[model samples]
Target: MQDKPVLKVVNLRKQYGSGCDHCDDGHEVTWEKNSCPECGTVYACNDVSFELYPGEILGVVGESGSGKSTMMKCLYFDNEVTSGEAYISSYNNGETNVFEESSQQLRHIRNTILGMIYQNPVLGLKMDFSSIGNIAEKMIAAGNRNVEYMENRSKALLKHVHIPISRIKDEPRKFSGGMQQRVQIAKALSNEPPILLLDEVTTGLDLSVQASVLDLIKTIRQELGISMIVVSHDLAVIRMLADRTIVMLDGKIIEQGLTDQILENPQHEYTQQLVYSLI
Candidate 1:
């Protein structure tokens, strides 16, 4: 039998500003209509939905402003959803929609059940804090109080991400961009979360650095069996990491299937253009 999905999202919507006159007429918002010409409402994400199965890597790919990151932000609770339901099977017996949970419950979920690595390391890491300290922050949030335990956990995670133990005391700002990203990964995995959300993790890195990060991600998934939602505009990155893929456009999922299937036989016009452009 198929395993139950670890996470499920239904009819998710996130919009900026009140509904406008044009939107009231049943006009769907496209990327070009981000700001409604009639009433100036911005549709950052509209009726987006997907599921993440246990130990599966789900890739979300789209151009900038396609609402890929917005969808992730909503999942991570960085952006509040206007309407919809998100259920994580491991949380509260999977009966509660996280969007409707209290702030304290959301905080608990973010700390213990979910781990996220932002596209910008600066957003995810404390640049001035020692690498170990950064990892310790997550541990502490997860209720770890023993100094020795926190230290060991941090060191082990750093080593797992291939950061040398000797460099554990150095601040993130002292490390290279790629190394900082690695440190972020270590911190994200410090608590052994069941689900990981990675948004444009390789966006601005050098080609070589991107490859290394991708390899590290693969290793983490293989070794830890963590389910991940990887968001990126680069099809190559998605191709490298995801087993299944979802194609988003103008705040909606336009196509989705096995990664190879979508790449080989794109059915949507937008997906066809996206795949062809990668050539």
Candidate 2:
């Protein structure tokens, strides 16, 4: 039997601004219509949906403004959802729609269940704090009060991400860009979350650095059996990390399939162009 998905999302929508003439009529608004011709309204995400199974890596690929990041933000509770349901099997027995949860509950979920690595290291790491402190913060938030345990966990995770344990007390600002990213990865995994959300983790890095980070992610997945949703505009990143892929256009999923199938034989016109452009 196929393994049940660890996370499920349905008809997820996030919009900015009040109802417009088009929205008033209950007509579907395309992403291209950012500002309604009749009345201004921004549609950042509309009718997005997907599932992520345990130990599976789902790649969300699209150019800028395609709402890939917006969707992830909603999932991470960094942005609020306008409508739709998101369920995590490990949370509340998957009965509660995460979007409807109270802020406190959401905070608990974000702290304990979901791990996120931002494209910008500054956003993910506390530059003022030592690398160990950054990781310890997550552990502390999860109710882990044992100082020794937190320190050991942080050191082990740092080592796992290829950061030297000797630098445990060093500030993130002192690290290289790639190393800072590695530190963020270690912090995200500190709680041993069942799901990890990686947003353009390889962007703005040297080619060699990108490869090393990707290799680290692959190793983590193989060793820990973690489920991940990797978001990127770079097809190469998606191809390297994802088992299955979803192509988004104008805030909507236009195509989805196995990574190799989507890369080798794209079905949608936009996907075909995206694949060919990378060749």
Candidate 3:
């Protein structure tokens, strides 16, 4: 329950290239055919850095091609970082640089110390399984194959997420997109991770639904005392959810400050453009 900054990212960089996926390192490859091999590889994230304090909401806002999503992926270890480091502080307030962690330790961190919520709720869940089934599956995986403990933990998580105990038995196909999104949140929380990464959690929801979801996230974060990193294109959402906002363009951070300060008095030309566009 240490309350200092829980996660710190410094000088992080991620690049995509022709032979990158085939690099001898142990990165899982997810490159596409259209990904350029001839042209010099693009830098998805370049020297982006930030810190998330315990129980704080740090929002990242940028255009679609901005490195917001890439940065989040790096923090969660979904994507291999080309350079730089992210530090994860432990429950006892001990800090370990993620880049220096062993594979086994990294896996433990991913399962027990960090959680991620993606832009698309559907993309994050197992559509083939029911909501409860998906939760059970992930709990087992995160707990490293403890099926009995997973079953109990999954039920407890569903209860915590405010899912009706009755509806916990139903499949995702029976629920609306908002309900599905709540289920995803519950699954992510099953591990009781110290840090949570949210990538456009409001992506496809309407204004009213989005507001409710964001409010729920805020409530949960405060109640659990967890640090969060949220990336979204919506400045309004950023203003509502983030204690601080980081602005990015062309794979670089243009500015970062308290949300109110950035909103009230943007200094950078890019920041002004973004603010004006919002207006």
lDDT of 3 by residue, 1-279 (tens): 335568878999887764344432425544332232334467788678888887888889988888899888887777888889777677335465687677777777877888888877766788768777887776676655777777777788777767788888788777777778888898888878888889988888888888778888988977898888889999988988899999998788989999999988999998888888888
The alpha-carbon lDDT assigned to residue 207 of candidate 1 equals 94
Candidate 3 positional error at 151, Å:
4.0
State the lDDT of candidate 1 residue by residue for 1-279, as single tens digits.
147899999999898888866674666645254566667777788888888998999999999999999998899898889999999999987889999999898888988999999998998999999999999999898888999999998998999888988899999999988999999999999888999999999988999999999999999999999999999999999999999999998788999999999999999999999999999
Q: Estimate each model's TM-score.
A: 0.96, 0.96, 0.85
**Once superposed on the true structure, which residue ranges of model 3 sit more than 4 Å away at CA?**
1-4, 18-39, 91-95, 144-149
Which residue pairs show collisions in model 3? none
Residue pairs in collision within model 1 = none
Q: Rate the local accuracy (lDDT) of all candidates.
A: 0.91, 0.91, 0.80
**After superposing candidate 2, which stretches have Cα over 4 Å from the reference?**
24-35
Model 2 pairs whose backbones collide = none
